[model samples]
Target: METYDALLASITPGSGETRTIFDPATGGVVGEAPVHTVADLETAVTAAVAAQPAWAALGHDARSAALFKAADAVERSAEELAQLLSREQGKPLNGPNARFEVGACAAWLRAAAGTPLDPEVIVDDGETYAELHYRPIGVVGAIGPWNWPMMITIWQIAPALWMGNAAVVKPSEYTPLGVLALVKVINEELPEGLLSVVSGGREVGARLAEHPAVGKLMFTGSTTTGKAIIRSSADTVKRLTLELGGNDAGIVLPDADPKTIAEGLFWGAFINTGQTCAALKRLYVHDDIYDAVCEELTTVANNMPMGNGLDENNVLGPLQNKAQYDIVANLVDAAKASGARVLLGGNPDPGQPGYFYPTTLIADIDNNNPLVAEEQFGPALPIIRYSTIDQAIEYANALDVGLGASVWSPNLTAAREVAARIEAGTVWINKHGAVDPRVPFGGAKQSGYGLEFGVEGLKHLGVPQVING
Candidate 1:
């Protein structure tokens, strides 16, 4: 196992213009991320274009073997990567945060490697035969978000590589070092230039999206940025898979036991300090159990330790960047101003050095309250009360962005019925934001197009071609 410093050193540029990465937990220096430019992006793209053909020629079995090795490589440096991720991304090492994200990287890589995608026989008659096959789209450009940076980057690149395409990653500016380190570890088992990270700014990302050589672009970030990427990739007509913003909702059915479901609801909303796109943000509790659910949720939230990611006991950490922190603070403040009851943690210490917004749970907030209406994307959740299931579903689906949602109820039958009506990619019964590598996940109605994960996700990474006779 490598030390954290060793892992950080591996990705650090020996000589170049660099950006100082600060630890969000302590405002301390994490490491220097190389400020790569558009020129660097062009060079990386050229290298990927040159490398893709031989990679494709290696065939699926060979590529899968390489990915499996890459997964092993990621495991070898897992501790180092986790520690570095904790420092750079401000996610706790112990929880489903830093270490979990690193583990997810390996899991996703292995899943992409092992998932079978044999050519499908569409039709076969005596007079005619037809089969459907997926071909590599050459070089794929991946632009990842700060939240779950390393894992989501793997989500984009793993399938691309599994399908015999090279990848060029552009990590979010807020958390580049973690991605750089992750890509470095994975590259150890793969051929040179097969996968690379361009730690650059918006300009480099813009170039990557628009570059003619990039046949596909996978982006996981804000809807605004997703749209910009769409426009940029339009001229090149690049195949794209975009997982954008999500203000995911969770409905607590009247039948749900508030005491029993409290922990699940807390973690679903507060995981990674609520930075996840699919993490439950707006929660609608049946009026019959509104007060009970709020009390239970607050009790659960109050117990979870929040502080520096390096601390073993602290499962919650600071926001990855100040901008996100401000967004959360402002939205919560706006909600408070709207006369919403602050069940717990509406106030944060002004003297706190880090962007440590306390785990906030706002109750009696209107569905239209800014905190409920907007994607706060932090350690805050708005609990809204609904008198009817129809009202809850209406509130949940009011927003155009629907990535994931959940209905908490013991009645799986009723839960499934509610799940179908909720406009989102995936809905969990009695849980929320529980993503599986084998299950397909994507957004609906402007939450961004294209599917990810499972065989469908693998298909997204390739271009389908039908052989007809």
Candidate 2:
């Protein structure tokens, strides 16, 4: 499993073609994975189709046992896996421990297990009895992104496995090794082919979406790609869960403290180098406190150190790839051309290599501007001003995407009121992008549908049928 060729033994590649995976921080070739052809995908799906029923038959308790063991394995290998992920993904390793992601995955498995499948019976009018039962939907096609490969994969696949379904997971081509390592350890406790990882490129992803044997498709990535998956899955009518792109807006109300909002603004918009699906991409500030907030945020952004993920003092890391770096650089440069001023960092350092870009802040940008409305998916934040709270909410909801939002106000009641008005799936008052294992998470509107990371997440794998006896 150390080499890319060793990892591809299970599925034979077509044409002997492969894609090179690079370290985002250093632009070094870490490994190579086969660019799986349509045939390779079919082979993997065939194996999943053959293996799913037996694995499902093992029941929930057996699944739980395997997951508990996987948790222990994750803890033992936390250091190595974290190092590998940091190398591939270009995220700060010290600030956010990779073990937290592993622990959360284990928690999801344990919570989803032992969920009763039996029908709940209730008699009405002393004659009629109605019952509700949950059943697994068969094989799931889970495609995870490279931003947080190990975390996002577990978020999508762990619940599916716990609900008695086999998953054929496709990790993003750029960061496949960490997940391969994770699956190897988990498969030790589960049956072979129960939890499989197919390492390849876009063709493999398309095959998974369109495959007839796949009962469901779960995807987390860009909006355009999510649309493609939805259209393809529609032909087979496969069950689908899409957690797509987000232009999450953070509103700083007039009553909000500039100092406090600055902290939330930094982490919400810049975490994972702003590769997060629900990261704050737009900022709406009340006209009364706008200048002060921007000044404070600029100071904080300037002080933040950027470097390779391995550096302990580096709070920010490079963009995961060249395309992302170009996207951020171009968008910021566009803003400057259109009269938007850079209050803080809006340029990359000349000395740094790879896709390293500094934390960027763009002010005086219109809501109609592309930078404010589109999903930038990079470490760039565009600030807009509004005089009224209603106006702020309108501006936030104006975007095509609505995954998450944050409303900051010193007055708790006012903040909750503002948070309630936001159109996104999850809204945090005096906080941003904060989530727990116990609550459901996802997006709404064009941002995408389907829930993840809670009891509702297990329900995503469920099929309901009426038994009229």
Candidate 3:
């Protein structure tokens, strides 16, 4: 393995003012990140705005070629990137964690490169010729989340750069290293400041949202922060793509097989320790198979081991920060106090060094409980029973936040029928939060406006310029 000091390159050695990052797995000091000032963010945004014209003027083919090379660069350094992600992000190195996230960087980069979104020749056959062109928006400010730090940052910046705009990133303070490293890898092949990183907390993010030079804002975080971003952008009325919080629901049909669905159910809720904006938080299962589903889900939860992310055998890891750890622990404790059945792994061992919460399953919980009503962005799943499909649908659609939802049933038609009724941006028939780079994802209700991924994602990143003659 490369020395730990090598990952430090991601953070440029700034002045005396620096922030120490802690390793989520061991709670040890990992490295220092520059406590970026508003001046630093302003500098980055100004540089991006200045750098954008040349990048956009390079034309699609040339820009794509450069991004393709960046993708190659990411693939070449996948190991180092994965290691850095595991150290700071507190996700397992293997499985759908750090390595998987690094691999996805390459995939998303390539997909962005290969996207064929040429100018559309609208009304070409008529007397007047008109063409609609997706033109580059100036500087795009990307404020990313911590859960899937590297991947989420890529999801914003890659498409923004590929669409012929310059991108400035401000990753979550908790998991900044991986994204910084990823950006460093890509910036090697690109023009200076076309892609930039400014590391700080909310103040930095708010500055980006309010920056006049930043024509677009693409953010992924909580719904509360998303509203703030919207408010901050009101000054500039900047275009935005916000993928906010999700209290996603999953409804299992009566005929579904518990054994067959258990693994998916486990991952749907537990992946990234349920920190995902789209991870299924509450499950509404038909009364006929509710007990069986609970049993199988409990078995899945028990079988999986949680530990340091660096361990290859472990699939689950610690909560990336203390605040989130407390949220999970307190919610689980409250659920236990409320007389809900703790099916598996509720008691957290505080004696342990890291912020480790067990894979908890709370059964027979009321819908109004915090674990059910709120977005429990941690490794806890609450299973609720409903007597009919109508009741399940009611429970699923009741929440104000709807980023994603799922319907599990053997009958594809029935699953699709129910999925249509759920008010979410992305509804999966048999899976929850199964995102593809080619499929668009957003939110409904208060989950936030705009979408990410696919052709629509690229189109929205830029302003539509029409030539009428």
lDDT (Cα, tens digit) per residue for candidate 3, span 1-469:
2344675664656565788888878988777777888888989988898899999999989998998999888888888888888888889987788899999998999888888898888887678899999989989999999999999998998889989999999999887777888898888889997999998778899999999899999999988899999999998999999898989999999999999999999999999888888999999999899999999998888888889988999889998899999898888888888999989989888799888898999999988899898887999999999998898999999989889999999999999999999899989987888999999888999998887888999998999999998
What does the lDDT come to for candidate 3?
A: 0.89
CA RMSD per model (angstroms): 0.8, 2.9, 1.4
Off by over 4 Å in 3: 1-4, 10-14
Error of 3 at 182 (Å): 1.1
Model 1 has an lDDT value of 0.93
Give per-residue CA lDDT, model 2, range 163-251, as digits (tens): 77888989887778778777776676777777788887788898899988899899999889999999888889999899999999999
Q: What lDDT is reached at residue 242 by model 1?
A: 93
Report the error of model 2 at residue 239, Å.
0.5
lDDT of each: 0.93, 0.80, 0.89
The full ranking of all candidates by TM-score, starting with the best, is 1, 3, 2
lDDT of model 2, residue 277: 86
Candidate 1, 1-469: lDDT as tens digits: 5788888888889999999999998999999999999999989998999999999999999999999999999999998999988998899999788889999999999999999999999898888899999999999999999999989998999999999999999999999998998888888888898889999999999999999999999999999999999999999899999999999999999999999999999999999999999999999999999999999999999999999999999999998888888899999999989999999997999999899999999998889888988999999999998999899999999999999999999999999999999999889888889898999999998899999999999999999999998
lDDT-based ranking: 1, 3, 2
Q: Give the TM-score comparing model 3 with the true structure, all chains together.
A: 0.98
